[model samples]
Target: MGEAIHNVIIGNGSAGNGAAITLRERDPDCRITIITMGSLPFYNRYDLPRVFRGCYDWREILVHPLSYYDDHSITLRRNSRVTDVDARSRTITFAHNEVMHYDRLLVCAGGQGYLPEELSDYRGLMSGFGSFEAAMTTYKALPAGGTLVMLGGDMIGLDLARTLIDTGYRVVLLTNEYTFWPHRIAEDERDGFIQALGHMGIEVVDGVHPVAVEEGEAGKPARRVIFDDGGDVQGDVVMPSYGLVPTAEFMLGSGVDIERGLLVDPMLHTTDKNIWAAGDVCQIWSAEDNAYRFYYGWNNVRLMGEMAARNVTGANEAFEGLEDERLRIDKKGHIASPFWEH
Candidate 1:
């Protein structure tokens, strides 16, 4: 509204999409550019489990196709990653050495390397369970009758457990808690899950916090999991779906406030005011910079994106949180959307 079309969304995930739509809703004349590290067509990263199980194609897995963008008058730059963010210059550098200038920038960079590695570049081994390529790669590589030891009992891990069982792989899921999903799951639900898990041939042993994951068998005899509670579980391969650590490395040394993610007020404005972060990469815990927090699924991303879009377009908007939202598929092929507390 001042000089140029004033909004740029970095990352084409749900959060970025939400920001774009919200900005456009507030100001149609404002330009919206979505930069994605992955290939074209935005999909719900949560749908990767079904993809791994071969339940759906990549296109079917996507939330919205390219046509949606064209219909909405959105400009998308997919199949590329943004390498650097220049706040002072108000530009984003892409992997192809292209520079995108922006009046207002919203960073929705999302997930990063979560698994611990043996080498200093251990970040390389921490492949995300999301996306088309990752699902195809991981599922196709899973050997039938081979032991699949999974770390973490959160939504992703549970979904993966269901997927591996359906694909004929023996699963051994270990977690620190004595019971799976202790925070919200009730006794009846847990029993049903246990029954279903046993029916699916999954062996879930609890209170065994995985201290180290190595290649080979589990326990004292073979290369196995040594838990914090001093327990052991042997297996052939280990897949960790613990959680996502925000992929905000590009902001390093940028002097933009970062509390796990880009520090922003409820209005989504960063310390620089011109910059913002959406999705799991924003400091959403407090109105002031404090603890860092995040949530899974597309709804949060969509809403976050919308909020950022509005802010970039000069209308200040506050984000409450995606605190209770939950979208998960159980072993019986039923989709549940009950709001859950982490």
Candidate 2:
């Protein structure tokens, strides 16, 4: 009976895809457009490690086939990177200099691998375990039985290590932390994991910080990694697994509140009333912590996207965050925690 609402969502990962579907379900007549920097539509990033290990093909990891977008009547734009956002004018400019107006905007651009200064100049020599393209590039460059120096003890690092080992590559895991998952697992559990990795022929070095990367010959990847303790290791491939940083560069001057991520309320609305944020790119208000914190993992991100969509469509659902019962599977295929609370 009234003018149709135009909803523009950034990113085509789980959060962006979930929000698009939920928005369409809630408001059938509304126009929906999903702009993504990636070339594919809505693929599962969690399967990237599997892609590297040769367990699954890149096409198999796709969450939804292209037909799904057509069936739902959602306009999906690939390779359209958002360059800037004008909150006041309710418009977004892409990397190609194309601009579009939107009635409501949802920023779910997710995150990228955090590259440390030591590895910054050697980006070409380093591979990221965070994205599909990065994983593929690293996998292609790896030679059979070649040594892989993994820098970081994060979940992605562990996953990459497992994949490389299973794929017949020698893996040396370097971590600045005292133990694997020092913050999450018990000391005994950490020790057990270290033993497990050793049994699998993977070397684990703890409390070792990387100082610099010694570049290799022309057309070759970094050959050596130097640590702060004056120790070093040579490898055919270097993979950085230092956590993820929010991909919020476009929101810099958009009048949106961004700390570690785009700050959002319990309802997933940003500082700007018409704009919302969800997934890894958003730091939602946590009642338990009395501050804004990241709610990670696939289940949490999907739920956040749905809730954000509901709020955007005037459903105004109060998000309580992910339930503890939800199972968290790390990149290594291990159930990280609380698969079933007793």
Question: Which 10-residue span in candidate 1 carries the lowest summed lDDT?
Answer: 118-127
Cα lDDT, all candidates: 0.67, 0.79
Give the alpha carbon lDDT tens digit for every residue of 1-342 in model 1.
266565778777878877777777777676778878788578766667776466657788777765888877888888777778788888878779988888888888886535544322323322347677876766655555667677665556666676777777778876533224313555455555555555656686755456655555344322366676777776655567555668888777666888677777777777886888888788775634465555455666667777777777667768876555534446664434442321
Write candidate 2's Cα lDDT for 171-263 as tens digits.
988865522431355545566566666665678777677877776667654578887789888888887877778999889999999997999
**Runs in model 1 lying further than 4 Å from the true structure:** 1-6, 117-128, 166-168, 177-202, 209-214, 217-236, 285-292, 322-342
RMSD for all candidates, in order, please: 5.1, 3.8
lDDT (C-alpha) at residue 145 in model 1: 62
TM-score of each: 0.78, 0.88
Q: Which pairs, if any, clash in model 1?
A: 15-301, 18-305, 18-306, 19-305, 19-306, 218-234
